[model samples]
Target: GPYVIPSETPRGEKYLSRIKLSWSTMATTASCPPPSVLLPIRTTTAGARLTSSHGSRAGHAVTTTGGAAHARPPLPMGMARALLPQRAPLLRRLLMAGALAASCTCFLLVLQAQASVPPRYDGFAYGVGAAAWKDAVLVEAFLDPLCPDSRDAWHPLRLAVERYSPMVSLIVHPFPLPYHTYSYHACRALHIANKLNSSSTYPLLELFFKNQGKFSNRATSSISSTAVTGEISKMAAQAVGNSVSEFQSGFSDMRSDMAARVSFKYGCTRGVAGAPFFFVNGFLQPGGGSPIDFSTWTSILEPLVAHHGQTIEMLTSV
Candidate 1:
């Protein structure tokens, strides 16, 4: 009927968030007969004692609705105690205490983990690139759209994706930290371009990065969803060779924030502390130069293209 508080219980965050200490009380009735005495006869005592053949037994009937429906005899050895008031109070106190302690411990552990992981993006993630280098190779690049080093590593991948076309697919992902102020906006703008034209996404992205800092971080981050649509529409006019209407449509229908989240998540998963990070076929490339070396990238990709060619030839013949 009333609430019960448990003491000394292990703590958990979820458990503490929305907790209700309630007890459903039920009532019970019992009936019991008094014990019958038997008299014993002795030669000196000369008195004979008689005992009843049927001994008194206690009986009970309980109902959840306060036992209003029925009543029953109580057993001589049986006891009925209210669970809510009698037992639940003590147990609730214990439980609440333990829960608080456990929740605190887990919170501390999470803080420790965050400390070691190097905060990448507590707010919005920015400055990473990912794309498909064709079915032959999946390219994952981490970059700071604002960082010169990241831009350096990014240019070659963009070029290869353009030059190679279907021979390769480029997937660009980034991990932007707070230190790089405009990284997120830059990455988001590129993502908006990618959404507009899946085929020519790479080159358009190169152009955007090539023409960086047109908008301030505060300006881009605060941009409305409708405004993003308009911005992407302008991309097609900037030597983008894509339909302005189509790009705007994609932006209108897209979840740009979630796009940023996925980009950040992937980069962080690959142990990226900073940009520009590159993973060619799950392999990490060193960063420190503007525009990654095409030779270094081809050293890995060319072989993959060759293998892919053989595979296609064999399959077609079959």
Candidate 2:
């Protein structure tokens, strides 16, 4: 079966496309040595005849009467011989061509192998020692801070991360849904907290998820965006143990807004359509938008952790 490489990013897709074009060009032009090198004629008693020992014309004969070589029907190799002075260059070209083709084939096979494996997660790590363990399963949670479903998933997801300990790493991406009026502000607040104190990120996320009702669209219907952000900054500052004034200052910093926007844009690239989305080892898990339980997460992660452990053990033994 043909291996289909999952597209991780637009840049990666462009890189793969360029490699494909190079492969195609190599296939068409370098598949065989030049005809001048492979089809040198030998003067025989019968006539001037050229014999091919490689490529499409392998084991065939060509006869020349005048100055031009003419193709003949397929015949036996009785007349084929090493009767040309260009034999050394011919072998050299054949070897060079063979080596080139083999290299391209090996490169493609390596790419196919990589395509079969799930991509490793590369994002901001959450929680203590979340990314400390080598070969840990990566669990990415894309959540809108004010989304009800995200709140519901928080507990079980936290429990799963704790249960797995160093064997699993969780990265929380703040994906603010457009419909949620204050979701973007909430996410920006979380990012501000992260910048203030790296360890405070998850705590602030938990705080937002727990008190999401206070910042819901209905609750803040009459409030201006500035008022909502001010309220969120208070909560973020308290959660991260920073001064409210300092956190509010961060809110005004364009970098915090840019960070939040980058997070949202990354979610879009990952095809996140709603809150509480997930990716296990970079493969999107369908139906992850709904809240998942601790038991369900365990069921999905146990075998994966065990397999990873076994792989490590095998590699060490070897």
Candidate 3:
């Protein structure tokens, strides 16, 4: 398996298309350097500037800036070539014609690995999004209702879903940590609330995040449980525009329990370790699970979206 190096660059689509057209399947037997790497790429008319080793140790990644275009550029070669499976001579010829920046080469390697096999568990993900489409990028977010970081990640992720609605699908799976004592209960409650009124999902989630302290604080724990129940009842009434008691009765229903179990199982089966795990197009986000701002997401997604369009155009032309 080739370690995926995530790249953010405008020209990725052409490179990806070229790799798909020219290269044979990359072997899974190839030695991988690390589990993941993040590369930040900036391109100018002159050439590309790549910041490598985004999430790994200092020496693991390599960056190239400014001088490649002037100097005889290195051949667009993936890192650790000895690790790659044997390829046809034609593959080498295509790579030599237009050299990719170091990071770009690594991204192509990741793409190659993806093309070689089926996804690990495509059906387990859940959330709001279009039906799965080959061309649409699948973004799976693992989040905890009680985690501050998850709350922070919500805003930027929402922006991404809105902006790239046509090109991407966002699926969120709740992963409540045990340490957050009432998190499971909250997850159950919210799931039922959302099921009762599908439109209430995001708003109720926002409400939970905004008032997290009330639910988690030691002083408020017992008192807040009852209080929060009432609060959710009020919210459910408002969301469903029905009698509060009727909505409240459904808040902790059996269906919500089943939904919570499903989400927890999905995360656990995938070996999700903590609060905020993100996967873009089935490739786990390379950088550690930190909350990325809107601009950062835009940088990562725009290239994928553009690459998708270019692929469609290329197919139409043929």
Residue 16 CA displacement from its true place in model 3, Å:
84
**Residues forming the 10-long window of minimal summed lDDT in candidate 3:** 115-124
For model 2, how does the per-residue alpha-carbon lDDT over 44-104 read when each residue is reduced to its tens digit? 3333333445444443444433445555444224323322233456788899999999999
- How accurate locally, in lDDT, is each candidate? 0.53, 0.75, 0.65
Residue-by-residue lDDT tens digits, candidate 3, 28-98: 34433322222334444444344454343313323355445322223224644744577779878778665
Sort the predicted structures by lDDT, highest score first: 2, 3, 1
Global Cα lDDT for candidate 3:
0.65
Error of 3 at 299 (Å): 2.4
Candidate 1, residue 24: CA error in Å? Answer: 73
Q: Which one is best on TM-score?
A: 2
Looking at model 2, the pairs that clash are none
Output the better candidate (1/2) by TM-score: 2
Off by over 4 Å in 3: 1-135, 224-227, 287-289, 316-318
By TM-score: ranked, best first: 2, 3, 1
1 versus 3: better TM-score goes to: 3
